[model samples]
Target: MSTVTTPKATTRKPPTRFEIRADIPAPGTPEGAYFHYTPAEAAEWLPFSVYKLLKMANARQIPYVDNGKRITFSGMNIRAISEQFTVEPFTKPARAAA
Candidate 1:
């Protein structure tokens, strides 16, 4: 009979917070700085579904950075996208004079 042995698997610790870098300069806005966001993080900030965010990226409607294997969005880019969908509150019309 032959003896067999298996190695134990190692677990990784989850990060407490996402990494946000400010050194990178945002495109178009030279004086402004922005942070990068993972796809999931972008979704949370946009308050939209991840699926929709990915779709927008794929369609080239939103700007993103492709770091070989993963994609990231700049804070400035997200803000610009959000502004397009902003809605104003509605108010009732004034009553007509007698």
Candidate 2:
């Protein structure tokens, strides 16, 4: 009789989230920092979908740069837009007694 052994399978780990840092300027001073990203990259970092991002850009709801051919989003603008749509969790009301 021959003994048989099975090899263990290996799985790849998920990628870690990237963190964003901004250089905030003093009051009454113009901002000098700028970072641009495509819709797909923005979608990866943000919670909104690519379609939603495009819709918002079309509606002028979010700040974006349109260079005649392509549309790009700035990191600062994305942060500002996300802040405007922030929502708190809802609390359920107490059940009525019979």
Q: What would the per-residue lDDT of candidate 1 be over residues 22-93, giving only the tens digit for each residue?
A: 454443364433666666666666767777877888888887765664667777767777776789899999
**Alpha-carbon lDDT, every model:** 0.65, 0.64
Candidate 2 displacement at residue 95 in angstroms: 24
* lDDT score of residue 8 within candidate 2: 88
lDDT of 2 by residue, 1-98 (tens): 99898998888742221322344332122442265656765666568887788888899888876766466666676677667788989999999998
Q: Can you tell me which runs of candidate 2 are displaced by over 4 Å?
A: 1-33, 88-98
Return the clash pairs for model 1, or none: none
